[model samples]
Target chain A: MKTLVSYDIVEDKVRRKVFEACKDYGLTNVQYSLFFGDMTHNRREELFQRLRRIIGRQEGKVLICPVCDKDLRLSKAIEVSAGMPEEAAEAAVSYPGRSRKKARAG
Target chain B: MKTLVSYDIVEDKVRRKVFEACKDYGLTNVQYSLFFGDMTHNRREELFQRLRRIIGRQEGKVLICPVCDKDLRLSKAIEVSAGMPEEAAEAAVSYPGRSRKKARAG
Candidate 1:
Protein backbone atom coordinates (compact mmCIF):
# COMPACT_ATOMS: atom_id res chain seq x y z
CA MET A 1 0.00 0.00 0.00
CA LYS A 2 1.24 3.50 -0.87
CA THR A 3 0.62 6.02 1.88
CA LEU A 4 0.95 9.85 1.68
CA VAL A 5 1.92 11.61 4.91
CA SER A 6 1.80 15.45 5.05
CA TYR A 7 2.79 17.62 7.99
CA ASP A 8 3.22 21.27 8.94
CA ILE A 9 5.48 22.28 11.86
CA VAL A 10 5.68 25.61 13.65
CA GLU A 11 9.37 25.45 14.59
CA ASP A 12 12.05 24.28 12.13
CA LYS A 13 13.62 22.18 14.92
CA VAL A 14 10.41 20.14 15.32
CA ARG A 15 10.36 19.26 11.62
CA ARG A 16 13.97 18.09 11.78
CA LYS A 17 13.16 15.98 14.81
CA VAL A 18 10.24 14.36 12.92
CA PHE A 19 12.49 13.48 9.98
CA GLU A 20 15.10 12.01 12.33
CA ALA A 21 12.46 9.85 13.98
CA CYS A 22 11.19 8.63 10.59
CA LYS A 23 14.74 7.92 9.38
CA ASP A 24 15.28 5.80 12.50
CA TYR A 25 12.33 3.67 11.29
CA GLY A 26 13.79 3.30 7.72
CA LEU A 27 10.90 4.98 5.89
CA THR A 28 12.34 6.36 2.61
CA ASN A 29 11.49 9.92 1.70
CA VAL A 30 9.48 10.29 -1.52
CA GLN A 31 8.42 13.93 -2.13
CA TYR A 32 8.18 17.19 -0.23
CA SER A 33 6.19 16.24 2.91
CA LEU A 34 5.68 12.70 1.58
CA PHE A 35 7.33 9.37 2.47
CA PHE A 36 7.36 6.12 0.47
CA GLY A 37 8.84 2.69 1.19
CA ASP A 38 7.98 -0.51 3.00
CA MET A 39 7.84 -2.20 6.39
CA THR A 40 6.18 -5.19 8.04
CA HIS A 41 2.72 -4.69 9.54
CA ASN A 42 4.20 -4.95 13.02
CA ARG A 43 6.89 -2.38 12.21
CA ARG A 44 4.27 -0.04 10.80
CA GLU A 45 2.31 -0.25 14.03
CA GLU A 46 5.42 0.59 16.02
CA LEU A 47 6.36 3.40 13.64
CA PHE A 48 2.96 5.07 13.86
CA GLN A 49 3.17 5.11 17.64
CA ARG A 50 6.61 6.68 17.52
CA LEU A 51 5.41 9.27 15.03
CA ARG A 52 2.46 10.39 17.20
CA ARG A 53 4.87 10.93 20.08
CA ILE A 54 7.27 12.98 17.93
CA ILE A 55 4.50 15.30 16.73
CA GLY A 56 3.22 15.98 20.25
CA ARG A 57 0.64 18.87 20.25
CA GLN A 58 1.95 20.58 17.12
CA GLU A 59 -0.60 20.93 14.31
CA GLY A 60 -0.12 18.22 11.65
CA LYS A 61 -2.06 16.20 9.08
CA VAL A 62 -1.58 12.99 7.04
CA LEU A 63 -3.35 11.30 4.11
CA ILE A 64 -2.68 7.74 2.94
CA CYS A 65 -3.86 6.96 -0.60
CA PRO A 66 -3.74 3.60 -2.39
CA VAL A 67 -2.15 3.69 -5.84
CA CYS A 68 -3.27 1.49 -8.73
CA ASP A 69 -2.50 1.30 -12.46
CA LYS A 70 -5.77 -0.25 -13.56
CA ASP A 71 -7.38 1.21 -16.67
CA LEU A 72 -11.17 1.34 -16.58
CA ARG A 73 -13.00 0.05 -19.64
CA LEU A 74 -16.20 1.50 -21.06
CA SER A 75 -19.11 -0.95 -21.36
CA LYS A 76 -20.82 -2.14 -24.56
CA ALA A 77 -23.64 0.39 -24.20
CA ILE A 78 -21.02 3.07 -23.86
CA GLU A 79 -19.38 1.89 -27.05
CA VAL A 80 -22.73 1.86 -28.86
CA SER A 81 -23.49 5.41 -27.78
CA ALA A 82 -20.07 6.27 -29.09
CA GLY A 83 -21.46 5.05 -32.50
CA MET A 84 -19.91 1.59 -32.48
CA PRO A 85 -23.05 -0.27 -31.41
CA GLU A 86 -26.54 -0.26 -32.97
CA GLU A 87 -29.09 1.98 -31.27
CA ALA A 88 -32.05 0.15 -29.79
CA ALA A 89 -35.44 1.67 -28.85
CA GLU A 90 -35.16 0.24 -25.32
CA ALA A 91 -32.07 2.33 -24.66
CA ALA A 92 -34.09 5.53 -25.07
CA VAL A 93 -36.26 4.97 -21.97
CA SER A 94 -33.16 4.51 -19.80
CA TYR A 95 -32.73 8.29 -19.62
CA PRO A 96 -34.40 9.83 -16.56
CA GLY A 97 -37.53 11.85 -17.32
CA ARG A 98 -37.42 15.45 -16.11
CA SER A 99 -40.37 17.26 -14.36
CA ARG A 100 -42.21 14.42 -12.68
CA LYS A 101 -45.77 14.98 -11.45
CA LYS A 102 -45.91 16.70 -8.07
CA ALA A 103 -47.22 14.74 -5.06
CA ARG A 104 -51.04 14.84 -4.78
CA ALA A 105 -52.33 17.21 -2.06
CA GLY A 106 -54.44 15.65 0.71
CA MET B 1 -19.19 7.83 -5.94
CA LYS B 2 -18.28 11.46 -6.74
CA THR B 3 -17.14 11.70 -10.34
CA LEU B 4 -14.93 14.52 -11.61
CA VAL B 5 -15.16 15.20 -15.34
CA SER B 6 -12.54 17.60 -16.69
CA TYR B 7 -12.43 18.57 -20.32
CA ASP B 8 -10.33 20.87 -22.46
CA ILE B 9 -11.90 21.98 -25.74
CA VAL B 10 -10.31 23.88 -28.61
CA GLU B 11 -13.53 25.71 -29.48
CA ASP B 12 -16.15 27.23 -27.18
CA LYS B 13 -18.87 25.44 -29.19
CA VAL B 14 -17.47 22.05 -28.25
CA ARG B 15 -17.49 22.89 -24.52
CA ARG B 16 -21.10 24.10 -24.70
CA LYS B 17 -22.08 20.96 -26.56
CA VAL B 18 -20.58 18.76 -23.86
CA PHE B 19 -22.52 20.55 -21.14
CA GLU B 20 -25.73 20.21 -23.11
CA ALA B 21 -25.14 16.50 -23.51
CA CYS B 22 -24.45 16.09 -19.78
CA LYS B 23 -27.57 18.06 -18.83
CA ASP B 24 -29.57 15.74 -21.09
CA TYR B 25 -28.51 12.86 -18.83
CA GLY B 26 -29.46 14.62 -15.54
CA LEU B 27 -25.93 14.90 -14.09
CA THR B 28 -25.96 17.91 -11.73
CA ASN B 29 -22.90 20.11 -12.06
CA VAL B 30 -20.84 20.55 -8.88
CA GLN B 31 -17.52 22.30 -9.32
CA TYR B 32 -15.98 23.89 -12.38
CA SER B 33 -14.99 20.41 -13.51
CA LEU B 34 -16.93 18.16 -11.14
CA PHE B 35 -20.40 16.61 -11.09
CA PHE B 36 -22.10 15.17 -7.98
CA GLY B 37 -25.47 13.69 -7.11
CA ASP B 38 -27.29 10.38 -6.70
CA MET B 39 -26.92 8.18 -9.78
CA THR B 40 -28.04 4.59 -10.18
CA HIS B 41 -25.52 2.00 -11.34
CA ASN B 42 -27.44 1.51 -14.60
CA ARG B 43 -27.72 5.26 -15.25
CA ARG B 44 -24.01 5.62 -14.77
CA GLU B 45 -23.45 2.99 -17.44
CA GLU B 46 -25.73 4.76 -19.88
CA LEU B 47 -24.16 8.12 -19.11
CA PHE B 48 -20.65 6.93 -19.82
CA GLN B 49 -21.76 5.66 -23.21
CA ARG B 50 -23.39 8.98 -24.18
CA LEU B 51 -20.36 10.87 -22.91
CA ARG B 52 -18.04 8.95 -25.20
CA ARG B 53 -20.27 9.88 -28.14
CA ILE B 54 -20.18 13.59 -27.31
CA ILE B 55 -16.45 13.83 -26.76
CA GLY B 56 -15.53 11.81 -29.84
CA ARG B 57 -11.79 12.43 -30.13
CA GLN B 58 -11.46 15.50 -27.96
CA GLU B 59 -8.87 15.40 -25.21
CA GLY B 60 -10.56 15.03 -21.85
CA LYS B 61 -10.02 13.52 -18.44
CA VAL B 62 -12.22 12.16 -15.69
CA LEU B 63 -11.59 10.83 -12.19
CA ILE B 64 -14.20 9.06 -10.11
CA CYS B 65 -13.45 9.09 -6.38
CA PRO B 66 -15.55 7.40 -3.72
CA VAL B 67 -16.60 9.72 -0.90
CA CYS B 68 -16.89 8.53 2.70
CA ASP B 69 -16.79 9.90 6.24
CA LYS B 70 -14.55 7.19 7.72
CA ASP B 71 -11.62 8.41 9.82
CA LEU B 72 -8.43 6.31 10.04
CA ARG B 73 -7.09 5.60 13.52
CA LEU B 74 -3.47 5.03 14.60
CA SER B 75 -2.78 1.60 16.19
CA LYS B 76 -2.00 0.97 19.90
CA ALA B 77 1.75 0.99 19.25
CA ILE B 78 1.37 4.35 17.55
CA GLU B 79 -0.51 5.56 20.62
CA VAL B 80 2.28 4.29 22.86
CA SER B 81 4.94 6.18 20.87
CA ALA B 82 2.67 9.19 21.32
CA GLY B 83 3.15 8.61 25.07
CA MET B 84 -0.34 7.31 25.83
CA PRO B 85 0.67 3.67 26.58
CA GLU B 86 3.42 1.73 28.34
CA GLU B 87 6.58 1.05 26.30
CA ALA B 88 7.64 -2.52 25.73
CA ALA B 89 11.32 -3.36 25.23
CA GLU B 90 10.43 -5.81 22.42
CA ALA B 91 8.91 -2.89 20.48
CA ALA B 92 12.38 -1.33 20.28
CA VAL B 93 13.54 -4.05 17.85
CA SER B 94 10.65 -3.45 15.39
CA TYR B 95 12.50 -0.66 13.57
CA PRO B 96 14.02 -1.84 10.29
CA GLY B 97 17.76 -2.49 10.50
CA ARG B 98 19.72 -0.11 8.26
CA SER B 99 22.89 -2.18 7.81
CA ARG B 100 23.20 -5.91 7.24
CA LYS B 101 26.16 -8.37 7.07
CA LYS B 102 27.75 -8.45 3.60
CA ALA B 103 27.11 -11.70 1.68
CA ARG B 104 30.29 -13.79 1.49
CA ALA B 105 31.32 -14.29 -2.17
CA GLY B 106 32.82 -17.67 -2.98
Candidate 2:
Protein backbone atom coordinates (compact mmCIF):
# COMPACT_ATOMS: atom_id res chain seq x y z
CA MET A 1 0.00 0.00 0.00
CA LYS A 2 1.08 3.59 -0.56
CA THR A 3 1.75 5.08 2.85
CA LEU A 4 1.75 8.65 4.07
CA VAL A 5 3.62 9.46 7.29
CA SER A 6 3.26 12.81 9.04
CA TYR A 7 4.53 13.85 12.46
CA ASP A 8 4.50 16.65 15.05
CA ILE A 9 7.43 16.40 17.45
CA VAL A 10 8.42 18.86 20.19
CA GLU A 11 12.07 18.08 20.91
CA ASP A 12 14.56 18.99 18.19
CA LYS A 13 16.78 15.93 18.68
CA VAL A 14 13.88 13.50 18.77
CA ARG A 15 12.27 15.12 15.75
CA ARG A 16 15.45 14.82 13.72
CA LYS A 17 15.68 11.16 14.64
CA VAL A 18 12.12 10.63 13.47
CA PHE A 19 12.86 12.41 10.22
CA GLU A 20 15.86 10.20 9.63
CA ALA A 21 13.79 7.09 10.31
CA CYS A 22 11.30 8.07 7.62
CA LYS A 23 14.09 8.64 5.11
CA ASP A 24 15.66 5.32 6.01
CA TYR A 25 12.45 3.62 4.93
CA GLY A 26 12.88 5.11 1.45
CA LEU A 27 9.87 7.36 1.81
CA THR A 28 9.84 10.47 -0.33
CA ASN A 29 9.87 13.70 1.65
CA VAL A 30 6.86 15.62 0.44
CA GLN A 31 6.81 18.48 2.92
CA TYR A 32 8.54 19.60 6.10
CA SER A 33 7.14 16.75 8.20
CA LEU A 34 5.34 14.61 5.67
CA PHE A 35 6.59 11.63 3.67
CA PHE A 36 5.05 9.35 1.02
CA GLY A 37 5.99 5.88 -0.18
CA ASP A 38 4.78 2.35 -0.81
CA MET A 39 5.36 -0.34 1.79
CA THR A 40 3.95 -3.79 2.46
CA HIS A 41 1.67 -4.45 5.42
CA ASN A 42 4.33 -6.16 7.52
CA ARG A 43 6.89 -3.46 6.89
CA ARG A 44 4.40 -0.77 7.87
CA GLU A 45 3.78 -2.45 11.21
CA GLU A 46 7.49 -2.81 11.85
CA LEU A 47 7.99 0.85 11.13
CA PHE A 48 5.16 1.71 13.49
CA GLN A 49 6.86 -0.10 16.36
CA ARG A 50 10.24 1.46 15.59
CA LEU A 51 8.76 4.95 15.48
CA ARG A 52 6.85 4.37 18.69
CA ARG A 53 10.03 3.39 20.50
CA ILE A 54 11.87 6.39 19.09
CA ILE A 55 9.28 8.83 20.46
CA GLY A 56 8.95 7.05 23.80
CA ARG A 57 7.63 9.38 26.50
CA GLN A 58 8.08 12.47 24.32
CA GLU A 59 5.54 15.04 23.21
CA GLY A 60 5.10 13.73 19.73
CA LYS A 61 2.32 12.59 17.39
CA VAL A 62 3.09 10.43 14.39
CA LEU A 63 0.52 9.26 11.87
CA ILE A 64 1.13 6.73 9.15
CA CYS A 65 -1.80 6.74 6.75
CA PRO A 66 -2.50 4.38 3.86
CA VAL A 67 -4.08 6.11 0.86
CA CYS A 68 -6.80 4.67 -1.38
CA ASP A 69 -6.72 4.23 -5.15
CA LYS A 70 -9.82 6.24 -5.98
CA ASP A 71 -8.61 9.12 -3.88
CA LEU A 72 -5.22 8.96 -5.55
CA ARG A 73 -6.82 9.23 -8.98
CA LEU A 74 -8.84 12.26 -7.97
CA SER A 75 -5.86 14.07 -6.44
CA LYS A 76 -3.88 17.00 -7.92
CA ALA A 77 -0.54 18.75 -7.36
CA ILE A 78 0.57 22.40 -7.77
CA GLU A 79 4.16 23.53 -7.32
CA VAL A 80 5.51 27.10 -7.50
CA SER A 81 9.30 27.14 -7.15
CA ALA A 82 10.54 30.74 -7.13
CA GLY A 83 14.12 32.13 -7.32
CA MET A 84 15.51 29.74 -9.88
CA PRO A 85 18.48 31.15 -11.81
CA GLU A 86 16.54 31.09 -15.07
CA GLU A 87 13.57 32.76 -13.42
CA ALA A 88 15.84 35.40 -11.92
CA ALA A 89 17.21 36.20 -15.38
CA GLU A 90 13.70 36.37 -16.75
CA ALA A 91 12.59 38.69 -13.98
CA ALA A 92 15.56 40.99 -14.62
CA VAL A 93 14.71 41.11 -18.32
CA SER A 94 11.04 41.93 -17.64
CA TYR A 95 11.64 44.84 -15.32
CA PRO A 96 11.88 48.17 -17.18
CA GLY A 97 12.64 50.18 -14.00
CA ARG A 98 16.06 48.57 -13.43
CA SER A 99 17.96 50.79 -15.86
CA ARG A 100 16.27 53.89 -14.50
CA LYS A 101 17.25 52.93 -10.93
CA LYS A 102 20.83 52.22 -12.05
CA ALA A 103 21.07 55.59 -13.91
CA ARG A 104 19.86 57.43 -10.80
CA ALA A 105 22.40 55.57 -8.71
CA GLY A 106 25.25 56.62 -11.07
CA MET B 1 -12.11 13.26 -3.98
CA LYS B 2 -9.95 13.66 -0.90
CA THR B 3 -7.24 16.28 -1.28
CA LEU B 4 -3.93 16.56 0.54
CA VAL B 5 -2.24 19.93 0.21
CA SER B 6 1.31 20.57 1.35
CA TYR B 7 3.36 23.72 0.87
CA ASP B 8 6.78 25.26 1.47
CA ILE B 9 6.50 29.05 1.54
CA VAL B 10 9.38 31.40 2.33
CA GLU B 11 7.53 34.60 3.27
CA ASP B 12 5.72 34.75 6.59
CA LYS B 13 2.89 36.98 5.39
CA VAL B 14 2.39 35.09 2.17
CA ARG B 15 2.63 31.73 3.92
CA ARG B 16 0.03 32.72 6.49
CA LYS B 17 -2.33 33.81 3.75
CA VAL B 18 -1.93 30.44 2.08
CA PHE B 19 -2.45 28.66 5.39
CA GLU B 20 -5.62 30.60 6.07
CA ALA B 21 -6.86 29.89 2.58
CA CYS B 22 -6.51 26.13 3.14
CA LYS B 23 -8.49 26.33 6.37
CA ASP B 24 -11.07 28.49 4.62
CA TYR B 25 -11.62 25.61 2.24
CA GLY B 26 -12.41 23.49 5.30
CA LEU B 27 -9.31 21.34 5.01
CA THR B 28 -8.08 19.84 8.27
CA ASN B 29 -4.54 20.69 9.27
CA VAL B 30 -2.59 17.43 9.41
CA GLN B 31 0.89 18.78 10.06
CA TYR B 32 2.70 22.10 10.24
CA SER B 33 2.52 22.62 6.47
CA LEU B 34 0.04 19.96 5.34
CA PHE B 35 -3.75 19.92 5.13
CA PHE B 36 -6.25 17.19 4.25
CA GLY B 37 -9.95 17.04 3.34
CA ASP B 38 -12.40 16.00 0.68
CA MET B 39 -13.45 18.38 -2.11
CA THR B 40 -14.91 18.27 -5.60
CA HIS B 41 -12.63 18.51 -8.64
CA ASN B 42 -13.82 22.01 -9.49
CA ARG B 43 -13.16 23.18 -5.95
CA ARG B 44 -9.67 21.73 -5.94
CA GLU B 45 -8.96 23.60 -9.15
CA GLU B 46 -10.28 26.79 -7.61
CA LEU B 47 -8.02 26.39 -4.56
CA PHE B 48 -5.08 25.77 -6.89
CA GLN B 49 -5.61 29.05 -8.68
CA ARG B 50 -6.10 30.95 -5.44
CA LEU B 51 -2.94 29.48 -3.92
CA ARG B 52 -0.92 30.24 -7.06
CA ARG B 53 -1.92 33.86 -7.02
CA ILE B 54 -1.24 34.12 -3.30
CA ILE B 55 2.30 32.80 -3.72
CA GLY B 56 2.87 34.66 -6.98
CA ARG B 57 6.57 35.08 -7.75
CA GLN B 58 7.45 34.16 -4.18
CA GLU B 59 9.66 31.31 -3.08
CA GLY B 60 6.92 28.75 -2.56
CA LYS B 61 5.92 25.24 -3.66
CA VAL B 62 2.44 23.79 -3.15
CA LEU B 63 1.23 20.26 -3.89
CA ILE B 64 -2.33 18.93 -3.81
CA CYS B 65 -2.50 15.12 -3.87
CA PRO B 66 -5.35 12.60 -4.31
CA VAL B 67 -5.16 9.36 -2.33
CA CYS B 68 -6.57 5.93 -3.04
CA ASP B 69 -9.01 3.82 -0.99
CA LYS B 70 -6.87 0.69 -0.56
CA ASP B 71 -4.06 2.82 0.71
CA LEU B 72 -6.28 4.54 3.24
CA ARG B 73 -7.54 1.18 4.55
CA LEU B 74 -4.03 -0.15 4.98
CA SER B 75 -2.67 2.98 6.62
CA LYS B 76 -1.82 3.34 10.30
CA ALA B 77 -1.45 6.29 12.66
CA ILE B 78 0.78 6.48 15.77
CA GLU B 79 0.67 9.33 18.28
CA VAL B 80 2.94 9.80 21.31
CA SER B 81 1.89 12.85 23.32
CA ALA B 82 4.30 13.23 26.21
CA GLY B 83 4.27 15.58 29.19
CA MET B 84 0.61 15.28 29.94
CA PRO B 85 -0.14 16.03 33.60
CA GLU B 86 -1.18 12.47 34.32
CA GLU B 87 1.94 11.13 32.66
CA ALA B 88 4.10 13.61 34.54
CA ALA B 89 2.75 12.27 37.80
CA GLU B 90 3.41 8.72 36.66
CA ALA B 91 6.97 9.62 35.75
CA ALA B 92 7.55 11.23 39.12
CA VAL B 93 6.17 8.18 40.85
CA SER B 94 8.24 5.74 38.81
CA TYR B 95 11.59 7.51 38.89
CA PRO B 96 13.29 6.87 42.27
CA GLY B 97 16.22 9.03 41.14
CA ARG B 98 14.09 12.16 41.34
CA SER B 99 13.84 11.87 45.14
CA ARG B 100 17.57 11.19 45.38
CA LYS B 101 18.27 14.39 43.45
CA LYS B 102 15.95 16.30 45.77
CA ALA B 103 17.70 14.85 48.82
CA ARG B 104 21.09 15.86 47.42
CA ALA B 105 19.78 19.42 47.03
CA GLY B 106 19.00 19.50 50.76
Q: What does candidate 2's lDDT look like per residue over A1-106, in tens digits?
A: 6677778888999899989998989898876787878877787788877887787777777767765545544444444455555454223211111243552342
- C-alpha DockQ of every model: 0.05, 0.33
Candidate 2's docking class is acceptable
For model 2 chain A, give the 10-residue run with minimal summed lDDT: A89-98
- Kindly report which residue pairs in candidate 1 clash with one another: A49-B78, A53-B82, A78-B49
Question: RMSD, each candidate, Å?
Answer: 18.0, 14.1
Interface RMSD of 2: 4.1
By lDDT, the best candidate is 2
True contacts kept of 2: 0.70
lDDT agreement of model 2 with the native: 0.66
Each model's lDDT: 0.39, 0.66
> What does candidate 1's lDDT look like per residue over B1-106, in tens digits?
3222323334466557766765675666532333434455566666665665555554333233222222112212111122322333223222111112221110
True contacts kept of 1: 0.02
**Best candidate, DockQ-wise?**
2
